[model samples]
Target chain A: MESHIELSFEDIRGKQHATLIHFIGDLDATNIELVLEKVFNLINEGTVNIIADFKQLRYVNSTGLGILLHFSKTAREKGGCFKIANINENVYEIIEIIGATTLLEIYDDVDEATAALT
Target chain B: MTTQRMEIDIQEVPESEGVVILHFSGDLTSECVRRINECFSAVGKKGKTYAIANMAEVTLISSAVLGEFMGCRKRLIEEHGDLVFCGLDLEMRTKLHLMGATKIFRIYTDIRTALNSYKWEIERQPEKFHVSFPPYLKIVPPLRQLVSRIARQKGYGNRDSFRIETIVDEICNNAVEHGRPKADDLIDLTVIIDPDKIEIDVRNMSDPDKVASLTAMLLPEKTDTDKPKPDVKRGRGLSLIKMLSDGMSVECTDRGTSVRVKKVREE
Candidate 1:
């Protein structure tokens, strides 16, 4: 069965060209391939500076967390950065438990992530 | 029919003493009866009488080899033990049925079923329960949610219940990611809930090599400075499980791997 997760992209024209991808449901192994493909497609299309808005994301497992980290690394490799904003407590707790709070760039909200995008 | 030579490899099933699994491959013909007999006799000499004949790769078998098989089974049964057959193909089943050997033999589709046929009694306590499912990621969410609900039902706080759920998620995800399980394999989850502490065990069938690499990754010997860099994508699931659970232990065996984690409720 497929996991219930949706991704919507919004382009932000500012200090750097960035794409804001909003996660609407749980991120997991079932839907990670699609998420990865979308994120890589953005990066290859010169939208390397990506901001992930996790405000609506309800749940995430280890597999989902791994891809988020991968996106951060891949975006940075192409002279851009991957930032996350508006993370819920449950998902943030998972990131803290895994000690990845410092690995991936995290902001308090979309505005904060956008202001810091480079 | 393909290769005239037959190959046999034997391994003792861990945690099940006196039980050995014999993997048979290639053609079992008259030339190989003596060798096969010697293997069976050698296992019997080692006092391992409960044998499982894995014929998943056998292409052909002569009448002499079939006779030898029956003889070995009879000898083991006489000693109050038995030999079982598993992973038999359609051709092999037809051959056995045509020879009327299926009536006297206990055959199963895979080793897991054959192992469970032993009917080893598990101690079912009031506060403990077990669940087994195929190794699929889609099956993990409900399992984790069930663990959390159980913890909450046992009076754990919301945060503690979430921690229990997180622990199950990471361990089960690790099993699916690194266990290298086949389609027929299963992942077993056992939970024991107490008033103050909860224990969870996740076990999955995997080969020895995958188990070895998982052991190294989960229980790495790296210092703080040698940890994965900020941009690292993997190698965090095991750490999350370790950090969330109060105590954790991993057991790796030839047949499978088991990870046990303990969580204590906070005040």
Candidate 2:
């Protein structure tokens, strides 16, 4: 399956900029490189306040989850806030199992997740 | 004395005074597994239960294909008919014997012996079932589990059932990890089941050149000291596949590579 990892920048009320990134398909060792590269590029471009939408992701293996964790840490260290939103049940359980929910702000709705980043 | 190198011809064998023989040729790797399954399905639908797979043309047969042959034999048995092998080269015979399939299947030197043996049985069991699968990898975990469920339903007990599950997972994982393209690649899987055995054929669209490297990495050479280095962590996946499967065969061609695995039901 093809993954469309899109990063869009939005100016929220002229006070903050939010980068919304959507992940799709199975996130395993196979395609984790693509995700990491995209996230790193966005971070290097100073797009720190971000929301990762996991709505279309069906499964996340340990390697995939690890990449997400590393990206969150890198974003945080760079003074940018990272939030996750629209996580489906399967991916949500994986994220929860890995205790990522406790480490990062997770929201059910995109608006709330983006709002948290702002 | 001349070596009398083996020669094989794939021809239709007529059995029971009317049935035709479906012959198989070349190596039975992952690529040819689907074709073999399709041939089985086509012959099965014709109400011809007894048939001979003339393997004289097959020079190199993989373990996966051998397993698939066992599965086919089990399938024919349930219909009161049987599948027999004829024209196996010496190397093929030795390999089959090593895998302990010599007792499980009736091997014949020629097609006539196999046909004569199945003539009466074919009369009583004319109905045959055939199944086929495409060459792609699908990530439907439920469907993957469903294959094992069908095997269990056929009375293949718990241990063999779990074995099937693990073998399928490892083979499919290899295709997903190494066979298909990075973003849009898919591994094609085809599974068939009868009363006695289950045959699974997996095809991955991978570069054939890499297969040798991958296989070598998975089956590394042992050092003279008889000790494995602690840091070398390769070949685990292939070792696991070999351990779990009753028969495993791999073939890499210009088009793609195919792996065939077969698990037989215990009586």
Candidate 3:
């Protein structure tokens, strides 16, 4: 299969404290780099706080998990926050399996992740 | 070589004779998986489940076929039968072993040996049916319907069966589109269903480079894409297959490439 992800941002709690990245489609070795590079660019832009929305994600492989970890780690190094929202059951299972479930702040929805981070 | 679309034949060993086997030849793939699903649905309609699959002549297989195999095996086991595979070459056995499927399915060296393993009641099986179609894009839908009907007939819940249908749709579309098929070019598909497992094979005349590219990505542990480029289309079909099926394999040859996929149903 191929890979597709739409990258976009929204402000949470009417404030621009965090960059809410909404991801759609499969995330694997094929396209994980594109996503990570975007995250790096967002951090460089000084919006260190990130809320990754995965509600629309169809799939994620091991490499994608690594990129997610790298995203969070990079945010932590910058003294900012990295959170996630709306992760579907399938991707969540893989996340849990990799023992990274506790590595990030998980919210049931984008609004929650946004509110908490902001 | 010859542009033969594909063919599906259900060869049932006579009841009073030897063990019952569903023999499949030609290309076994997602498109063919539907036919295999239909055969089992037909078996399910008759309220039977004991099955053995013979893959002596199967030259190709796909991931959807693997998913179907596992689904059917689980169904058969629930009904008090087992899905056993026989007549596999060393390469096929290694493929199953590598995918960690050998632990689940009963493997045999040959039909005679597989039959000798147990005395199965020859359940007056239905006559085998065969169908062939062009590799053209237009006919893919009806082909997928055959698999969807099998899932429904096998009593799969709506969502579960739909997943199976989608897998078939994705692979067949790829097979038709990616195949550097000349005019009148055909891909062969075959599905064999038994109480234990379902087998699907797909064969296509493909450029060696295309085969190499797919094979590399198919192995995830040692993986990377050909190169990072703007993927105009992105929905990892191969990854989805790896996630869903019990096992899969790709065989590349000078003439063409064949892929076989098998799945062991959850008990």
TM-score of the B chain in each candidate versus the native B chain = 0.50, 0.44, 0.48
For model 3, the stretches where C-alpha displacement exceeds 4 angstroms are B1-264
Total clashes in model 2, counting residue pairs 3 or more apart in sequence or in different chains: 14
In TM-score terms, which candidate is top? 1
Say which candidate scores most in DockQ: 1
**TM-score of chain A considered alone, across all candidate predictions:** 0.95, 0.84, 0.91
Per-residue lDDT of A1-118 in model 2, one digit per residue for the tens?
Answer: 4223443444445435457777765665446677778878878887777788777765554456667677777778888877888887646654554445666678898887755654
* Candidate 1 structure quality by residue, lDDT tens digits, B114-203: 776553312112378899988888888888888999888766888788778878888887787767658778899999876778999999
Off by over 4 Å in 2: A1-17, B1-267
Off by over 4 Å in 1: A13-16, B1-126, B216-232, B252-255
Better structure of 1 and 3 per TM-score: 1
Decide which is better by DockQ, 1 or 3.
Answer: 1
**What is the per-residue lDDT of model 3 for residues B60-131, given as tens digits with 9 covering 90 to 100?**
656677678888889887877767888888887787788777888888888876665545223322222233
Model 1, chain B only, scores a TM-score of: 0.50
True interface contacts retained by model 3: 0.00
Could you tell me which 10 consecutive residues in candidate 2 chain A have the lowest summed lDDT? Answer: A1-10
